[model samples]
Target: MLAWTGGGVTLLGLVMLLVLAASRGWFSPVARLVAGAVLGLALLGLAVWLHRKESARAGAVAVAGTGVAALYLVVASGTAQYHYLPAAVGLVLGLVVAAGGLGLADHWRSPALAIGAVVGAGLLMPVVTEGWGPLLAALTVVLEIVAGIVALRRGWPWLLVVGAAWAVLYASLAAGVAGSAELWPAGAAAAAVLVVGCALALYALVTSSTNAPAYGVLASAAVPMLVMGGRLDGWRGAAVAGGAAVVMLGVALVPRLDRPVRIVALTVGAVALLEATGLLFSGDVAVAVIVGEGIGFAVAAALLRSRPTLLFAAGFGVMGVLGALALPLPPGVLAGYPASPFTRGGLLQTGPLVTGLIVAVLTVGLAVAMLVALARTGLLGSGDGRAAMWVVTGLVGLYGLTGFVVGLALLVSPDRGGFVAGHAVVTVLWTVLALVLLARGIRNTPLRVAGLVLVAAAVAKLILFDLVSLDGLARVGAFLGAGLVLLFAGVRYARLVSEAETATGPATPPTGVAAPAGGAEQAAGDDGRGTWGPPDART
Candidate 1:
């Protein structure tokens, strides 16, 4: 701490010398620049000599860092402030100083010096350029390449993060305040950073820890993405995000790539795809596309047998369902098209009808894929996680089934009658599906609970939605159909439960532990085991 403090204090004094000297006319511009350079060289010489003695090695590195900062100040002031050196000369000198400082830091194993070098240079650029986008962006590119190469060689991934943060700050300002012509340079800078960071990620990917390099790769991608996303969020922005998605996916898919990096890439790619979908499509069409993509990701997860992949699949699938409810109904549907679906035209001519059908199919697929992924990854735990999944999948599947039937009914009937009939079909479908799930659930408690939930939802919809949405025979048909289905499902599930209980009766009392009340009692099972209580009570 003392060493660093001394270095910082000395660096500040050098700045004061230049400022105070000019104000007092104590030296010419050349004299002031030469004097600063001389002081910086003296510090470097002192650091080298001190490094020979183990006791002073730490202080030596700190002083070397101060000397690096001193050189940067002199070069920057000479070029931009006093006009002593040409801009190119100043930039070349700056890069040289940065390179030398980083090399020393790496060689000395001094992260403190490395951080100071990258941070000091990054902070000074904005001040010198006064937020000029092109220059700042260009310098950002050069600085990243220099700093990143040196840092990665020493397994220093965090420096890249520090460097990228500055790049992003510059890129953001450029994207927001600078002209369009200047934005591309910032984009280029981001691309450069990502490319180099990827190299770091790929290096020893099989053995090296995944977190450090993965963050570098992600941050490298974030610069242009967040900046461009905030400002250029239409097709142009979509294009950029889509391009980034493709790049990251390529990085992720590389053979033998780190798992964390691959998962990160896939996750970011999923977001990018949805972002593009929103930019390109609206309402149900957008929801359908998002759901479709999510389904595809789910299947990929299953094929890969990856837990992280499945988790993302579950998230995106939920997002689709939520978005469906949050967003308004599609074009024609909003205008009461379902009541008389085609007063003007046919199914092909009705945009919302077409979109509704598409969305319905994808949404249903999303549910199925979620379960398949969970099963693939052995993630269907017998706990709340499994139960929540079942419930969510049931709702998603119900939404899809209802949409599909409604769309089909509207297509065939194209009147209020068809709309009511479509809903009637929906109710029937829900009841039948619930019965299947319940039968399957007899052995899986969570599945049974999900089936019961569906039954409740179907009953609610019949009462709340169908009672008002339909009329005349449509209402009667919906009610009678659902009621009969419910009655049949109830009888069938009851019988199935009885059969299951009879097939697996309670175990015989342990040896020397006599049956309750009397040593011998009447038994119900053919195997001589008794089952005289409610199924749950016996268990």
Candidate 2:
């Protein structure tokens, strides 16, 4: 502790010497730079000699690390403040300091020293560049390379975390965090950084011994948005996103890749695809592409049983729901929020009529596909809450459906009459959809639960909103439509139960429970899925 504290204080004092010299005009800038460099070298020489003895090693390494930081900072000050060296020359000198520090740390096997050198150099970059410009962007790329090498080398997961944190921060700034940065340049540099991250991630996966690969893989997967996110509103943004998506997709396609790596790649690629599509195209065409991507991803998730892919599919599906009703947002079909879906409006826009319908249908389809995938693996009702994923999915699908219905009705009539009429239609639609889900019976427990929940919501709306809000024929139609649908659903359910029993046998209840005349109908609990137990319990 004392050694480290002394090293830190010594570095601070060296910084003060430069400050005092500049304030007092004690020497010329060249003399000041030369003085600092000579002192740093003296400390380095002293530390090398002391490192030869076992007793002085800790303090020796500490002094060496502080000297390296001092030299690097001096070079930065000379280039950025004093104008004593060209930017390129100062940066090259900085790298030499970094290399020397790393070689010493490697010889000493000191992870802390290596971290100090890389981080010390990197942490000084923004100050040297005075923040936000082409120079900083270039510097960021160089820093990313340094960080990547540190991450790829043995011993120092924190180094990667620190590097990634800086990468994300600069990428955000470059993207226009304070709106001061040149967006394209920053975004371009961000792309390079993401590429570096991906390569490191892949290397970690192929060669890491501990947690190095996991951190690298996950960071690579997440960095694309930050890197390209600032300029996603432009063609340059599109290029970065498109290239990133392609790279991730290619990585995912590599045979025998680690499962986590493949999953991360697929997830990031799906996002990049959405961003790229939105960036390259406009309006209905983009929505159409997104719809297709959602469906394809969902179906592929079902086939491949990839939960992460399915999660993205789920996101794409919900983005549709948000788009349909993002009312305040102006023109274009989700020309806004598929890539960033949290921008949903208050159920007002429901988008263009055709676009809403298309997206709503896709949302529902994705939900069904998700359920099908979970079913094959018996994931639902397993106490993992996986069933809720599809339930929320289905609910959003219905939300899009309702928005479009009202939006279309308003489009047709543009008055209170249209509004009432839309609600009437939605009431009937909800009832019918619930019945359809219920009709799937014991084989689909999750759907059955969703059906019951939907029916309850429909009943609440019918009593609370429609009963008071609708007038004359609109109110009559809601009540009448729902009643008839309920009747048909009841008869169909009874018939299906009879057939199920006749095809199988008199339904058997668990031990200690007597079979009633109603048999399986009563035994199956409220969901009519026979007590929806965990998967292994059934067999």
Whose TM-score is greatest here?
1
Per-model TM-score, in order, reads 0.73, 0.63
Candidate 2 contains a number of clashing pairs equal to 3
User: Any runs in candidate 1 off by more than 4 Å, and if so which?
Assistant: 1-42, 53-59, 72-96, 155-161, 198-221, 247-285, 328-349, 379-382, 435-539
lDDT tens digits, residue span 208-324, model 2: 546653555454544635355534566766777777788887787665677777777887787777778777767655665666677776776677676666667767765654554
Which digits, one per residue and each the tens of the lDDT, describe model 1 over residues 431-450?
Answer: 88889989999998777887
Question: Which regions of candidate 2 are displaced past 4 Å?
Answer: 1-6, 116-144, 147-151, 159-396, 402-439, 442-495, 506-539
Displacement of the residue 243 alpha carbon in candidate 1, Å: 3.1
